[model samples]
Target: MVDIRPDWQLLIDGGKKDSDGDGQRAVVNPATGEEVATVQEGTAADVDHAVEAARNAFEEWSDTSSEERARRLYAIADRIDDHFDELAEIATLENGKPKNQSGNDVFTAVETFRYYAGATDKFYGDVVENSKDELKLKVFEPYGVVGVVIPWNWPPMHTADFISVALATGNTVVLKPAPQTPMSSIRMVELMLDVLPDGAVNVVPGGVEPGVALTNHEDVDMVAFTGHDVTGEAVMKSAAENINPVMLELGGKNAAIVFDDADLEKAVSGAILNAFYNSGQSCASIERLLLHEDIFDDFLAAFLPAIEELNVGEGMDPNSQVGPIIDEAQYDKIQSAIDGAVDGGAEIAAKAESPTDEHLAGGHWVPPTVLTNVDPSMPIMNEEVFGPVLSVTSFRNDDDAVEIANDVEYGLTGGIWTSNLERAHRVAARLETGMVGVNRPSFVSLGLPFGGYKRSGIGRKRDLTETMREYVRVKSIQIDHTDARYSLDLDLAEQRTY
Candidate 1:
């Protein structure tokens, strides 16, 4: 196993390593309820130092050519690839995701950086043809400094989502990783320092104090945050103080709709994977599954058995498909939601058996739960469970399915399963979500724009071209091409009169 000691330090001004003045905090392992490591808690003062360092580095870094930036990004990606196994082990230990899933997270992060690196030369501004006598050029300039606050659910992958675009577009960054899973981010920054200039990438690991300080700082030009909606609102308010633009990826109550004519086995597998993946800690988890009345019974018969067969244990166990919840609070939330749903007349279709191992008695483990006869209005159906609990409800027809899927505050992701191409296209158009999967589950790709529609989020995340645009400011330059320098002759006389 990778070293689980607490010797990590904050990365400031790219290569400078320093200890936080605020005392240390323990990073707990949710799988075993033990302190995996200890990290220094960054305070408001540390945030100021980080921002100042980033601001100082912005002038030179932003002026560097896109080709050089791309080279540096590729180097970072290579470094990550070299240490992929160690990083994945750290992620699984801290984030409580299964080993394979954590490895996927690392691979995704590496690929994301490489994707942005390849697009460095392709993100170009436009030129408008307004008039023959004047030349109009649109240019994209990097924001001086950007603050990125990443959540713990997807540490390595989410950090890469913002950091790659920001650095590739020539913007310096001050990142604040979640306190729970700071080791991987710290290690990432450490590796990046070999190629990145000082202050080009800095990290402050802590809780609300550092996050608020970073968001409200005067020097930060923009903020990119991914977390719950409640905290997202606060980040927005803080950003508004300086009129700084903020990109938010908030919570979601995603749904998967299964039509009668769809492939039953495919739909069942998609729903199970979408619902229980990462123990349902993902924002795009399909907490609500709307099945057609004609196929509801058949869907459950297949879905329940699959969910029951899933293994739940420690993340390091190769056989474990589902791991423990992140912490006590998350475990309690999952329990409360499940109990509340059952109390509201929802029947439990399937629930996995808890591990009987004596060592796992104190772990924050929750079994995979599938609930049927769920009312669409129930809190478990409408609210984001953020756990391995899938609530199934029946819809009469296509219109009913659309209505049920769209009747929620979140519009992040939805799935449509059907054999009829026309019906799939029609229903996909009606579902109010940022992304829809026709025959499969919703997933992120290199070039696709990923974000939510309604209260789910504020801006997009993926797509190298689109993401680079968000971190930069656009400027339109107009030049007078004509040789004639005709100032109105009458203007002299009019100026004297005025």
Candidate 2:
């Protein structure tokens, strides 16, 4: 078992590591089904202290100059770069991400921080055109304290993305990491404290209690969350009592549509990546593969072999391309979904093999699985399996493909595999999703805004003045050139609307 580092968890009021009578929880390694370390769990009371700390620090931190803030944010990015290798390893061991994918998450964290840092001085409000008597303008201001809740998948990257945007927009934060993967996330908050001011960012590591406390806190001006839809619903409902805003990026049952004219090689490659990356634990993965009838057999001929070649084993293996499911419960859930589908007549078209080593026997391994003869109404097809599982369905034409793609409740993201530019644009426009990738999968980055439609999610995550828009509140100011009460300019009887 990996040892615990006392300095790396349960921080409140800036860099102070504080805990109440609540005990620690075991952090598990999904690859071996063993305890990696124990992290202090922050209780509801800890959230109160963190919120208070953030409130006390908000004004001073928000008042800092933009240039200085940029410098400090850049410093945090530099620190992430310095620890990139270490963070990658830590995340892999804890979260069961393949080595390469873990590194990608960390690298994206660096990019996220730098992206928002460069954008510090770039956010702008608007000037209103009005009559000559008065000057009217709008300005953006930060929500004093933001409550952030992130998921277990891609912990470091999600932590970096959410917190950087909040701090960049001059908001103080109270962050809560998922119970499944808290070590690296708390370590990340520790690194940020080295550069950011005390209390500017605080982290509480725990299960549901801390998250509920943070979201329901009256002092938190806004709440940002990324997770499953059920939890997001609770968060939104709780925060509504105070009428504070919420930014929710929830789950997805994304689709990948392959047209008849698609480049088979490229389509197959992207489909493979989408179906199996991070053991298909990504919300943006192609949960459903809709293929043109003309290319259905041809695509599977190439796609099935690729799935078999992917290595499913320990995360640290240099050759490993797939990792275990996050835990036993999730493992069983995915298995049940597959079993139920098969019992309901869905056939297992192909499945990859996991490492046969006895040490890996304890791991919650989910081989890359593909299901054929699946009905759109099947639970596996409609619900989010969130495992290395793919279901294939054939479409006769464009309209059928779009209908099948849009059939699910989730519209987080989808892709079109076609070489024709016009068809790509036309179909992409028709698809129901927040983002689409033509001929390839879209990468979540600093440039493109990320979110979903319908039950998928609530808001976008990007550095656009628009993604930056949600982090801030707008206030309008009016200045009258004449310093008069203006009672003479208006007649009460004429102005009255009976």
The candidate that achieves the highest lDDT relative to the unseen native structure: 1
Supply candidate 2's per-residue lDDT for 328.
93
- Compute the lDDT of residue 158 as modeled in candidate 2: 91
lDDT of 2: 0.87
Q: What does the lDDT come to for candidate 1?
A: 0.89
Off by over 4 Å in 2: 1-8, 130-132, 488-498
Write model 2 residue lDDT over 198-221, tens digit each, in one string.
Answer: 788899888988999999999999
Candidate 1 shows a clash count of: 2
Clashing pairs in 2: 14-199
Rate residue 210 of model 1 by lDDT.
91
> TM-scores for all candidates?
0.96, 0.96
Q: Per-residue alpha-carbon lDDT of model 1 for 120-215, expressed as tens digits?
A: 999988888668798899999998899999999999999899999999888999999998899989888889987987888899998988999999
